[model samples]
Target: MRRLAVLLLTAFTAALTLTSTAGAHWHPKPTTAAWQWQLQGKIDLAIEADVYEVDGFEVPAKTVSALHRKGRRAICYLDVGSWESYRPDADRFPESVLGRAYAGYPDERWLDIRRIDILAPILRSRFDRCRRKGFDAIEPDNIAGYENKTGFPLTAPDQLRFNRWVAREVHRRGMAVALKNDPEQVGQLVGRFDFAIVEECFAYEECGKFSPFVGAGKAVFVAEYSEPLAAICDQAERLRFSVIHKDYDLFARPWEPCFP
Candidate 1:
């Protein structure tokens, strides 16, 4: 009986140690990557890239499988900060959590990040769906809603806390997460996210702000909608970012790749 008790205690200790180790390095950040974001259809799969970003819930599992077969990683794009009217789970959000319309998107409303206790579970369900669909990573959009007129008096700290929770939750599911935009917080968050996807950073002259990601050996995938293609391409190559020019819709439109 004494020997059996010792063995059980040893096993319990091992389990705790393993859990702690996983919590420390479970979400190993990506070192290098090239990715394509297409919220439209499967044509993105044919774009000859190392990674493809597809609509989180709308993409079929077969698409992820196909990307895997081709030695590519698949990322699921989810909007965790805004309530889209077209999403199937749109009604799941309570009225209290919904705020003013997202600045340019009339159909979408910013979510009150302060209601994280209530929102986390809903986001978990969405991330679970992404995992079930076999996505290798996640691209959470609208993370900077706090910087906008969200109608909730959101602070930078509020955005940072919510973004950190998002990173933790995604890592808990064994999937990598990328920090979208919110360039102001890049210095504080570059270590938390695996990679980054930025829009018009060059146009805004903020590309240098995100260089820490590449300095840490993680890839920065950028898309510019309005910059002169030639000028942006030059800067993109110089910065070592996987840069492309696409329309605002992010459909299968003409793309100007900066690298090769």
Candidate 2:
């Protein structure tokens, strides 16, 4: 009985140590407010960019290392709401989880985020991949699909539950996560997400919606694809947004920065 008790105590100690080590290695804070979200390819070392937003799946670990060497943080961009058939792990997702095709993007389909039991593991694995690749944070795109015709009857509540879960999972993995353009829930989710990465918020007149995030002392990164620079720059500055004018494709293009 004495020997058994000692063994149990040793096991408990080992478990506690493992948990502490995992916690320490996983949680990385966002280094800066300014960042680039380029998913076109690998890190363009010649571009002299501060942050390289690369495809979470395609980008290799070496590229992340190179960016770190330059004292730059790398953000891994992954599609959490929509399913792209081209990804290597595409086969892992079952057909039932796939709903209608996303409007304008033929290759992508909306995911049934209601099925968290099925989808959470997949997303967690994706986050794990980003963590393994040395990514400091994650930018999960298409998070606002519930606002569009996703074919599934996704309510605001459904979106809220899914978005909150995504944030929690990323945090659990010790990675900072960004809320990507779910303007309606900004007030509620601002505290949950580390930052806000909004696309064309100026054009949509929804920049005001995400003020909560900025008020919470979190960074709001805005990218305007179609809005006139002169018109949006003033509002962007007033809102304290790190705004940039970029093309729709989001490649390494000449961007008009609203802030110095």
lDDT of 1 by residue, 1-260 (tens): 99999999999998787566436532323333345778875556567667678898888898889889998888899999999999999989999999999877898999999889999889999998998998888899999987798889999999999999999888777788899999999999988898888999988999999899888878788888888767876667677788877889888666666654
Pairs of colliding residues, candidate 2: 26-174
Q: What is the C-alpha lDDT of each candidate?
A: 0.83, 0.80
The residue pairs that clash in candidate 1, if any, are: none
Question: What's the TM-score of every candidate structure?
Answer: 0.88, 0.88
Q: Write the per-residue lDDT of candidate 2 for residues 32-93, one digit (tens) a residue.
A: 23456677744466655465677899889998898899987788899999999899889989
Off by over 4 Å in 1: 1-34
